[model samples]
Target chain A: MHNLEAILAMGLVTLLCRATPFIFFMKRKPPAVLDFVQRYIPPMIMTILVLNSFKGLRFGLAPFGLPEIASALAVAALQLWRRNALISIVGGTGLYMLLIRVL
Target chain B: MHSNSEAPRVKVLGPAFTASIPVLLGYSTIGIAFGLLVVKAGLPWFLSPVMSIVIYAGAAQFMAIALLAAGTDIVQMAILTLVINARHMVYGLSLLDRFAVCRRWKGYLIYALTDETYGLLTTVSPPEGARSESFYAAVSALDESYWVAGSLVGAVIGGLVPTEYTKGLDFALTALFVVLLVEQIRSIRRIEPYAIATAATVLAFVLFGPANLLVIAILASIAGILAFRRRLP
Candidate 1:
């Protein structure tokens, strides 16, 4: 019940975030902040998220974060080259899975 | 007469399904990863499908696993979900005109407006003679079903596998973010946002540690962007 409550709360908040613009800005012109966020926040958030994904890595220890960095660069390079998200993700993740064990 | 009349329905349905193929691939894989993560984090497998069906936000659902593992309170969980999913607000803003055609299904369409679904809806047009609302609804429903089905599969697999075998599988999430980041970069073709985000992330990690890193970094990035707004272009 507790876990369900938490999940539902998150679901409600997510719905709120998604629906806010449709609810509030349907008729009136949206604020400048909305435009600013649309233009800037997306890329910023993406960068932050990619970096955040590395939060669990141990930089000072063995392998020295190489697996994470190498795998991420592989993901980026493959994405840039193929432009196919699925292939890039699978390839990068496969390499990471192999690398963490071998290295 | 029957085949002739059913022909038009096929025309609409076929193109919509084709358009959803890319999303079907992306969502299923990522959704599976999320499901494995939920079980790996010590939660019940059933919660995987529940989160996918209810929250339906990929990044937030992944974050929820971590939040639950940490035993975070409902209020904090809600706030984090809000921050992570704030981008959906912009998505809804851009979608208003397109979704206006969705009279009966507009509410459901808005609820299911994810990053991939938004991209497809905005870019891909319905085939000739098809209703736009029907096209949107089909794509939305198909994408969510793929996600839910994929998560269910992963959750079951997670329960069976030795935990060690799934060790580096979470890298799938990182790879997803990287792929998305590359796409974002291609579209924006700007440097300031990336630079500000990097700085904000470093500052947050050093000052606050990873505990509050994402929220603080996001706030700092917003401040940094606002301060340099005039010079951006």
Candidate 2:
């Protein structure tokens, strides 16, 4: 029962956050402060997300985040070149898997 | 008779599917990962799709596994859900104009606005000659369906794979995030946001370590942006 409740609670909270803007802006223009947030936050969030992925890697440890670093670099370069998201992801993951096994 | 009526609506499906193919790949792999983890944690098969439907936030679901394992309560899960997926509001706000005219689908649209869907919608316009709402609806539904289907498959197959064999399969999610991050950077023109955000993440990691890093990074990024906004412009 609690598990189900937790799921519903999560869904409801998610719905509320998503609905907040649409409801608030239904009758009025969003404020300038919101405009600032709208403009600047996406990149910041994206950067944070990218960093979040590697948070488990101990920088000072033996493998030293090398596989992640190499794969990330490969992802960036491949994406920049081909502009194909699927290629970048697959290529990077493949390289990461290989590096982890080899090194 | 039903087929005749459905013809126009079905025409929109192709573009939507094409646009969503990348997410189909990302979500399927990550959804599988989350499903496998949940199974490893001793949950039932149906719970994977249930959680995917309700707690549709992909990244947050990964975080939730730890809490679920620890037997966290509903209230705590709700709060955690809010904190992690709070970014959805930003994406929602950005699309307020586009979504305003899409009133009837607003609820459904908001519900399906995950990061990959949001990013894809940001880049791609509605298909030519298609009903605008239909295009958005198609893309949204397709993405979620990919996730649900993936989780369902993952749930069924999860127990079959030995734990040792699943190593580094988890990197698919990270690789997907990196791919989207690259997409975000390409769309964005400035260096300051990236630089400031990097510094904030590094500083937060150093100060707070991994446990509190998310809250710290979010705060630092927001603060850094506010303080530096005037300077930038």
lDDT for model 2 comes to 0.78
Worst 10 residues of 2 chain B by lDDT: B161-170
Report the interface RMSD that candidate 2 achieves against the true structure, in angstroms: 2.4
- Candidate 2's displacement at residue B15, Å, is 4.2
lDDT of 2 by residue, B1-233 (tens): 76543665877888888777667766877788788888878766777899899878886777776777777988888888888777676677668767767856778988888877776666566776667777888899999998988788778896565656546655765666677678777777888888888999999988878865765786688788777767664
> Which candidate leads the pack in lDDT?
1
Model 2 CA lDDT for position B16:
85
Considering every candidate listed, which one attains the maximal DockQ? 2
Which pairs clash in model 2? Answer: none
The complex in candidate 2 yields a DockQ of: 0.63
Q: What digit string (tens of lDDT, one per residue) describes model 1 on residues B1-233?
A: 66554565566667777666656656666677788888889999999999998999887898899888888899999988887787677567667667766688899998898866776675566888777887888889988998999899889884564547656766765676777788888888888999999999999999888875776887788889888877875
Q: Which interface RMSD values do the candidates have, in the order shown?
A: 3.8, 2.4
